[model samples]
Target chain A: MFEYPALFAVAAVVREGSFERAAHVLNITPSAVSQRIRLLEERIGAVLIVRGQPCTPTEEGRKICRHVERVAMLEQELRAVMPSLGGEEALESRITLPIATNADSLATWFLDAAMGAAKRQGFLLDLSVEDQDHTATGLRRGEVLAAVTTLEKPIPGCDSTPLGSLRYRATASPEFLERYFADGVNARTLAQAPGIVFGKKDTLQYQWVRRAVGHDVAFPTHWLPSTHGYVEVSLGGMGWGMNPALLVGSLLEKGALVELIPGLCVDVPLFWQARRLSSALLDELSGAVVKAARASLLWTGAGR
Target chain B: MFEYPALFAVAAVVREGSFERAAHVLNITPSAVSQRIRLLEERIGAVLIVRGQPCTPTEEGRKICRHVERVAMLEQELRAVMPSLGGEEALESRITLPIATNADSLATWFLDAAMGAAKRQGFLLDLSVEDQDHTATGLRRGEVLAAVTTLEKPIPGCDSTPLGSLRYRATASPEFLERYFADGVNARTLAQAPGIVFGKKDTLQYQWVRRAVGHDVAFPTHWLPSTHGYVEVSLGGMGWGMNPALLVGSLLEKGALVELIPGLCVDVPLFWQARRLSSALLDELSGAVVKAARASLLWTGAGR
Candidate 1:
């Protein structure tokens, strides 16, 4: 059994970390907040908060709060769609698509296909981004209608369409490359070179080294987990490591960083996959993706 | 965007179909039930019941109710595991195995594997079943820790352990076979035979008939969606069709069902697959499964 305050109220409290501040932020009386939390706990039979100083969640409270967060998120997305739902004529045919993608894509060019599709046909968008590697998790959970995955196989009940390759080059600032690989970048020399990595768990650099050397090689690698920070570290000449071409374009153009091995890039073919729900929304989204892939990476065998 | 009553409340209403009935069931006043429904609607922003002779769901209401049902199911499962969670001398690791199987296997033998593993180590079960063809969907979604699948190919980011072949024989009551195939049981003759099917969406019979003959053949089939009922219909001499050997052992012994095609049974190889999470729980579960498979089926391939 679990309960929490209205999601917005709970979220406000969590964000502010105090009932007084959360009440102020939400423009509600502190007594009201206290009463709501008390009522919620009574109904769910789970104490949600530890009342002294900054509040913390009981185990059950954490679960209930998580539920609230999910509902809040769904509500935010639903709000974006509710406006269009006003007209009952289109209501029957309307279906919303929930998709999960990477943050980089959301900021970059991922929305182009969706935008084009929206221009022609109206649909609601529910997008959640974790990370490229973990996108499949979202697809598996039924949280998303479709996903962009590093995984090649389709989730059951869903079909996969290859988008295009995402190629990354082993690159570094000219200063770093010159300082470390002045002897012209051989396998032994490269193995000893200091490197910047995407994250502790990110094995892109290690994989690149193996592919280049045709064997397993361990190196003293520095972890800069942030996508933006990763390129910044490489650009600052901290070390040599693989970077997405799209992200390091400015550095490449400025001649600040040089590719250690030209055409020795890794191409991870992207895919758009979704469950085989007999949903017209899915079909429309699929059509939009196919069309966009033709204009973007779909033709370069990125979608093989 | 979508909200219904808390799972227990929804269960009560679904059980009784009215505020008064639900109030009586829960030993609460009808006013309390009305208040709960009103609050639930405001929180979920979905109209769960139409103000009519009987309650009905708006689309959003149906979705919320579905979520309530899912939450209810998970709660029941969690309660079952709660007792063991309190007993902790050694640090026991929990791993989730996601498997996709038909409901019949899920309700039957799958639980046996969990029971077998319970003595050796502590485990958490995350059971999800789609149709045999859709079990792989769980793998794609990562909802399951492992799966029993019909697909030959392994999903990405996971490995597959072949459990063995699951053979479906064309079986029916002796009386049924006698009536349907009075002339003889051959491809063409069976095409003209009446058949019992799992459901309208089930195409097993259709596939069997098409494979048997050089051309596509249609059989006059009646729908019996439940697995037990499908077998029952065939056993009652109402029709002839396929039935799993595991469920028909006693009937076969009693000569109630005779196999129409001897040694021509269709065998779909099953697999146990999981995400490549490096955890002790998965390792133990995998060990139990491999041991079970050794004792159970005809597996040749290796997977870890």
Candidate 2:
């Protein structure tokens, strides 16, 4: 069997981005850290790291880090099942699992899933928030083991599970509508009004406009790039934009935001895509995420 | 001369990601929008777009869009110089220029540059906040017209100019340093103490540790992924981490943060990398950015 200690050392170095820092985190001398990494690299017959200002892992190193992360999760599950076999290291060890997800989910319900998983598996999660359409790119590059994405399809060696949909409605503060869109929702008028967007890649507002007006229209946009900020900006009368139904529940009731198009809604279906790791901890993490997604998202029988 | 109206329509459709939206923005019919795109495509003898849920520009289409944006900017600059020649459309037209930049610059001083350029050039800015080290990838991919990056090396066919450097220091609340490092800054103790990090790709903490301790060491980190949140977390004594000198002026004066390693500072050099656009407005934008960067960042004479 591969040396678990050295493998964990490699994983730590990759995560921490420095040999000294990784050594410190592992509570080993820098020399010991170097020796462990060298041992692993020698055994694997590959240069694992490109030592620079802040060292970066090689492609081979990334593969090993991903494998070690999975193994650590499996070990955690194994220890959970067979507590009698647990040693001092297993009792207090916390593996780092880097994950990629969209900004909207992270702002909504994904944190609950992550906290639940952390509590249950005793692993620290490193979440990298990107756009929903692109999170799977991280999974493909082995930068992240799992991602919550819009793609219903699976990667080469991954599993994709349906995780409900986030339903959004075009909304604006009443004052914003009265000021900018006084002429009503038409092609000419949409061009004059501003809309808040999450990022350059956000197409929710455009898609809503296409559906609502029966034609695509170009308009000015305020790129907030934050879920919370986007909502606030829209509600603060800076712009009119799509807000998730789950998040706008209270605001809708309080009449803080007026739905511009009552029947027009955009449904963004989400999926939990993960590298097909045999670890029960991954299964547990997926379970927690699915549970949380269901709790907040509109249930539309998976694979949308 | 070469159907500026049709070309602008194509660019708008690409930006808005829909034909209907482009049509609305242009104050034209959807059929007219489609016709303009078809006319442009037919003239160029190429497929300009891949019509999907969110229509994307094809390779040739991207080139045309980029050219049109540049031409629009040039026209705006021209109108500025010769206001008597400006048409009604020229008076109100706003070109969109997408740029990639690091989060630190965005939070610190880049917005002022963007606002200055926008106010002068009549352009809407789409800023994609990424890490400085990787912003060049966006430049290479033609995803952005320009990027503020750490790489002094110019991307092929792009202009790279020195934009000064951000100075960072290892800092934390005085109470935190005392509590965590009562014995001293050692690997064993650092592993147990939490540190706030901006993102997974952020290596400021690791770099600081390497410089201060003179060895690579691993440590626990809390990835906040927000410039503002990371600072607040550090100030609240949640964790110790590197804070930019420009950002922590007030905090340093108030003794909210104590330098963990005195005289240990990391200066990350930055470059403004941009496609060699022939537009006068792009030149103006770069001048504004360089001026702003000089005002904030420590100048290292270029080519570092």
Candidate 3:
């Protein structure tokens, strides 16, 4: 606590937006919160928070807030394994590990891995949903402990393990395909057809185009960023997209969504990236994630 | 096309995951795609895609892909304004504008902004839901044309205008409040009480702690990450959270969610940040956004 005591105050001020309010939360007088901030600023040689309508953190202060979050997470982590550590002082062990994952994975298989890990080794899972292409950013910022990413290479100071590939196939409602692709898939038709995309960061639809039409072409796109929304929109005949293999199951069986291009699928190989820590919980997480991915995702590469 | 002709090819190869598939889509020989890629690499002086089990793009390649996407978007914008630019080449005028918005805003008032903009001027709203604390990242990356962000300062090469503040109050299901705060909300109780959070980035719950207990404390929290989910989770009695004013409407009336603190509310100031470009479409968008915010958001500061 001494190592990062000021950080809690700084975080409180940033979160609460004022010293007085932070004091209220800490059960101290506003002056005490101010004194602690003053002492902390003097110690750190930087003004941590701007006293404004809603207080904001300086760049340095933000770094401290992030550090505080990390340390608090670790402290809970420590108490989780070593119960005697915070025993009487802490009534119950509550450790939340925030992990970044893709929307597709969340709808399909990510939770199974999370639940498996939680059941075997108890820890609350706080999932932060970001596109697979960008989930690594959260990991880099220490905003998340682990991530499901498409990047093959490991982030610096992190361990990367292959976690199989999330399979996607070009799909749309039969009515949509019948109307739009009546003349067959081509650059001109693709350029005019409405397409469903995950978001700006999503490249799967474009990849589908390259595989189906053999060129990169832009079309009128409908961005249904959520996994379920993407599927629902595709089924509603709004547009077509590359949907996760598992999510299309019931729809495919019911013939609600027709595969635009059969046998031609895109494979986005995923990897579990985590800090190279000698923590049993992380090790358990890695195993659970790998197991789930292997069971669900396509085997394009060796997942070890 | 000449500036980045081969870029389209490179993007195709990356998307298709192989030169052969890209060639197939293009109705050309695989060798042709390979040759174009080689020439493009020579021109850029950087290797773009790594040929692999499933091909992937390098950092330089990703930048090129992003550039292609931006160019495509701008092209659509251009064709929208000057229909004769493409003349008979293109017909349907469906342009999707990617915009980043905080979840609370997205659920409460941002859609009206989007709808107002869309109705007056035709365009598709590709809304990317990010927390208010971090929406600026999307703006900086050019992933979104505009964003509803908390930062008062504008990103470089972007214009910033205050859009008013989103007011939120600490709320929980009556049962949750009764169970957790029955003994009174002190640091001890807060540390053990279950909490609901939007994501790791969400600090409103902590702000509530600062307001209620007068200090910084951590609680066992469930992360829902979506706007509706945040309310649903809080109402489900999983825990307590600070909810946006309008989102808790009927639930508040019905006592589904009870305010933990009676009048104390946090006002998160928002700003509309967009590229400093002279485009009528952008102007229309700005007007609609400001209009919507004014009608819904609190006038904490002089908007101008």
Candidate 4:
């Protein structure tokens, strides 16, 4: 069995991203932190942490850190059931739960869910933002214990729960409409006009254009990665972009933003996937996510 | 001489992240795009584009792409001076200018500057968000032509202009103060209370705590990566965090958020670093950035 103390040292070094910072967190000397890491690596027969300006973990280190996180979650649950197991230190110790989520869900409802879970469980949240289509890769890589992803199917050793769909509208400002699509939004106009893309990874606008124009139309795009920036730039007549319905509903109603094609929307279904662990904290978080999603996201009968 | 047509194909493939999409943008067949890449590789005797699900570039590929971007900027300037050189097609061809910036600046003032530049030049912006301390790395790597960074000194072949310092205040909601610092915010209380962090890269809270408490206090932190989310979570009483003065000014005035320690602020001086190229567009962008920064950021004369 691995030494729990040395395992925790490995986890802290990775989390803090430096041996000195890890020592500060662990309340040990820097040399002691180094010795613990060296001992852990020797026992495992592999190098774990790569020393750098900000230390990074090797593949073996990541796996060990993931194991440490799982153990920490289980310990939290145990302390909850038996308060005497840990007294003041238990109350003060906040386990960090690293989870992956997309920008749209985070901008709209993910925080409310996260806040609720953090308050109830008294834990710190470490959120990693990624495209919804790719969030599951973090789970597969053991980088994140839970993720809000578009994958309906769960990764092995993980439980997937439907979190409903986030709807998007291809929105543009009044001035943008007049300038680019004065005649109408056709394939030719779209091919000529500039659009807004989140990044290279984002294909929302491309997919929407294909659906609206009945074919793939390659348009010039301004890549702004921020979810809120998408709305701001669109409103400022920078470019038409796929803005979430939850975000642009009021703007659309106020005539600040108009859909490129009225009534044409894309509903991207999201799922909450968490490692299958017998931890009450994870269950509580999953419940909060489902509750928040139900309150904010659209749930068509066929979504499930 | 290297063919401009094949060079453009290389830039488009790198920008679009795929040969097929590059073909769409270049208005050519995918086979032709493949042939251009193959020919370029043969001439250079080095692999340019790596064929993948979403294509990536080798080191040589990146260097070539940077050259193409500079050439495009020069061409745009040329077209501007002699309007008769190109007609309708020139007006529609919007070049993508990749720039790096910190998230706080983007949320507060960077987009306004970007909008002005984009509107005047009719170019698309591809923004890469990094920490202020690390934004220069992108510029150094040839990944971005310009950056809003904290580096006061210019890179080897770049121009660095002072953009003023963005002031930050360590803030928390009233409830958070009462709950966490009921006794008083000393080193002991600080070590126990949870804080909010942008991510592992953020050290604002740590710096502030060390300055205030007179020692390094390893406090628990909730890592929420979004700039807007930071304010929302702080307002929601999740944790105390360092918030930009521009974003939390009204909140502080309205008593929605309170500083942990009054009269103590961290001023992160920002500089605009762009490649020293003889292009009118780069000069115009530099002017816009400087103007916006002067208008929004705090300029205590010593910032220069």
Candidate number with greatest DockQ:
4
For every model shown, what is its TM-score relative to the native structure? 0.37, 0.68, 0.61, 0.97
- Measured with DockQ on alpha carbons, how good is candidate 1? 0.01
lDDT of 3 at B202: 72
Interface RMSD, candidate 4?
Answer: 1.8
Please write out the lDDT profile of model 2 over residues B1-304, one tens digit for every residue: 6788888888878877678767766778889999988988888899988896468888888887877777777777787779797663621366667888887787677766765676555466666778778888778878788999999888998999998889988888898889898888876677667676876568777788777777755565656676655576577676787888888878988999888867689999999988887777677788899899999999867445
Off by over 4 Å in 1: A1-30, A47-107, A111-131, A136-148, A152-162, A271-304, B1-304
lDDT tens digits by residue: candidate 4, A1-304: 6697789889988888788878888888999999988987887799999997568899999999999899888877787778788733422367888999999999999998899799878888999899999999999999998999999898999999898899999999999999999989999899878898997878888789888878888888788999988889999999899999999999999999998899898889999999999778888888899999989998874736
Q: Write the per-residue lDDT of candidate 3 for residues B1-304, one digit (tens) a residue.
A: 4555477667656544577656654556788878888898898799988887357788788777656655655676787779778722232234456678887886677765665575456566677778798899878876577899998798997899898889998888898889888887788778767676775467787777787777677566567676655675577666778889888878888988898767878888899998776656777888888889988999866535
User: lDDT of each prediction vs. the true structure?
Assistant: 0.59, 0.78, 0.74, 0.88
Q: Rank the candidates by TM-score, best first.
A: 4, 2, 3, 1
The weakest ten consecutive residues by lDDT in model 1 chain A span: A87-96
Q: Candidates' interface RMSDs, in order?
A: 28.3, 4.6, 6.9, 1.8
Task: Compute the lDDT of residue A126 as modeled in candidate 4.
Answer: 90
TM-score of 1: 0.37
Give lDDT tens digits, candidate 3, residues A1-304.
Answer: 4644456778667655577656755556788778878898998788888777568888778777666656655676677668677632232244556688887887688776675675456566677788899899888876577899998789997999888888898999899899899888888778767777776567788778887878777676566566755675677676778988888978888898888877788989898999776667777888888889889988766335
Give the chain B TM-score achieved by candidate 4: 0.95
lDDT of candidate 1 over A19-40, digit per residue (tens): 7645654556878877787787
